[model samples]
Target: MTRHHPRPRPLAALLALGLVVAATALVWARAGAGPDRCVERAERAEQRSELVTGTGPEVLVIGDSYSVGAGVQPDQSWPVRLPGRVRVDGFSGSGFSAGASGCGDLSYATRAPRSLRTTTRLVVVEGGLNDTDQPVADLEGGARRLLRLLDGRRVLVVGPPATPDRTWGEVARVDATLQRLAGEYGASYLSMLDADLTYQDDDLHPDPAGHREFGDIVAAQVEAMLTSS
Candidate 1:
């Protein structure tokens, strides 16, 4: 009878298995370390938190078509449906750049109150969609100017909603610039593009259901911020 010996496991195979295990453990550790980064990323990616609130403290929503009703009813808009006592100053067609032609500017400059006086504590800005046609630097400068106009009021900077067009890369650039501005100014930066409200009848404006969903997102963020503040 010949002696038989069990074969040793292949070193390369063992190494590969080890690497996989190590990678999996590393991922698990990272995920367990803090607030679900994945969930946060998903939420931020959706860009649904454009409308900021200050219900208990006082709140204001100011922007263009995205802020306004667009295809949705005025009451269904985030600024309108947000919980608690809130005020809306949204204009349907405004842009950040001065004299920028569109519904945002006309509504913002002509209709919306220049200075909120009703014990206003928080302000949400939702413009810049129209500004995509302009240069990024111009858009940034316009945003800065808008922030300056707000004075001492606590503000939240909301970037424009995303469109289905692949060529409209300017939206990302504008959103990034606004987010940087928000950080510089110590304000909240919410991305309408990340909110996942991209599906619209015209591929530009959100429908009524979209508005309601967006409003809920904004309301949650506002409520949390106000409660903490």
Candidate 2:
């Protein structure tokens, strides 16, 4: 007499398979699945209007983790904290030339078109820190490409802040490049090279207090630029 064990049940196998798939999906999502998953769209609608249209005042802001408020809430981001309605589109680990290592090709230039709107009077592009390791030419070219797409529109290029972990020289180079491009494109440039900003545990992103301080500084700068223009 032969003793044979019952084959594994199809239903049990299917359940186990489903769990595995679900776990994998969760991991993938956390690992920068796509722009929708990584790029945060935040808006502060109740503030005073700056750039107005039929739909009301709106400003488009695009950048990386710093712009996305990496360590804080959506409302805490500098863009959102700025006066008026701000449509902030931020992808972590991205920049003008640098693509997010985990989030596919989500550079400032690549995401610019999607966020640009006719009604918006101002387009604020805040980034460059991620491109610190990239070549100077690459950074310039990337910024130029994005500025070209924003031709004829109001643009404010806010260079990345100096982080404790990053080399100050590289950060300054990126800032200088962005400043030059902003001048060429007739856009306003806000250099953060001298900004004494605090960061989170990672030493890369700003903390809540840092975001607030950054927002205040940027808000003042933006207001002055708009008033002059």
Candidate 3:
């Protein structure tokens, strides 16, 4: 009888390859999944509030370095330009998923409620650029947590702007996730990628002029929403 022996090495190699492919597919799928659902209602409230308020509504801008106007001053940031009392609660070096243990205690979602007690009419949460470097699951969980915290509030989600170093595909994915999250949470989603281009500097953080231009675009969108409402 002929000895029948399977090639263990080839089989092992094929199995490893299959595992790698499957893992990659899973990561891709998770990354592509839409934003967290907890904040959908807040997103909607933002739109409705915009339509009803007419010109300008109270806004709370919360995030990391981006929202803090890293390279710019306080006055140039969008939070400084909104019609009503605009409170800026962004922290430098704080990632969207960052907690007290990671970097700082001021998370965009957590610090927001604590800082602004008087029923802020609108809230803008922007972060995730830092989280992109972490695991996709971590990003999703952090986003969901933030959404949950914003439940029953009005919110508008600003996503990560495009960078020359990052691929357009990555930007699109991030933006898509943001839009989906806004939709699910009932908030309005705005793209800052295009607005970023109008700025003169190529630094990850925009300059004062860049901040001013960004503020204008954001103000216009807020105005439009208020007018429609």
Candidate 4:
């Protein structure tokens, strides 16, 4: 008896080929889109953050996701709700040299040059959690670059809030270094570590109510800074 080999199953072959092609296309799409999307989103966030569209002139606040209000509405973001016309230059996933994404080299040093004008009033910078792993030298350098850019403008440097992702020890180091930099530059330093606040599910950012409280504290700090200056 001659047994003929079963003919190649056209349906099975087609389904296998289809799956392979689909998977390949998906990988290609992700590979092409990932970095470009990162940069594009970052740029758009920056553009949105810089509008001088408030009541009058503006106070500037610059930082990462927190400053941009990641988990909340643009209007509800603390910077917009802040007591004055506020110009902001915050972007998510940004830091001096470290962050949760894109490895974060988007430091204030890089931003303030392009974002700040000589006429800007006071600037508040809220970052540190993103700089948790940064070298003291790098952190200081970033802060100094920003302070120099501000020159005669009043500035405040805000420390990050508590996050379970980092040990308090790691967070403290960054805060201490920033505190030193603030003193050196005469920019005020406000530690959220000292605030009575609540956080969102992510624990990395604050909720709407938290932002309101945060805006109040920042307003108070700015008022004091303005009065003292």
Better of 1 and 3 by lDDT: 1
The residue-by-residue lDDT of candidate 3 on 1-229, one tens digit each, is: 9999975678788899999778756653543311232133234323322332113466677776656665554555555655555666665545455432133333455665565556577777776565556555655666667788888876778787776646666666667777777788788888876765434354466667666666777777766655565
Q: Could you arrange the candidates by TM-score from highest to lowest? A: 4, 2, 1, 3
Candidate 4 residues 91-209, lDDT tens each?
A: 77666542233523567777777777766777888888867766777777777777777777788888876676668888888888888878988878898776666678877688888
Clashes of each: 14, 0, 14, 0
Candidate 4 regions exceeding 4 Å error are 1-37, 50-57, 98-104
The lDDT, on a scale of 0 to 1, for candidate 3 is 0.60
Best by TM-score: 4
* Residue pairs with backbone overlap in model 4: none
Considering TM-score, which of the candidate structures 1 and 4 is the better prediction for this target?
4
Error of model 2, residue 123, in angstroms:
0.9
What TM-score, over all chains together, does every model reach? 0.67, 0.74, 0.66, 0.76
Q: In model 4, where is the ten-residue run with the lowest total lDDT?
A: 96-105
Model 2 segments beyond 4 Å from truth? 1-56, 98-102
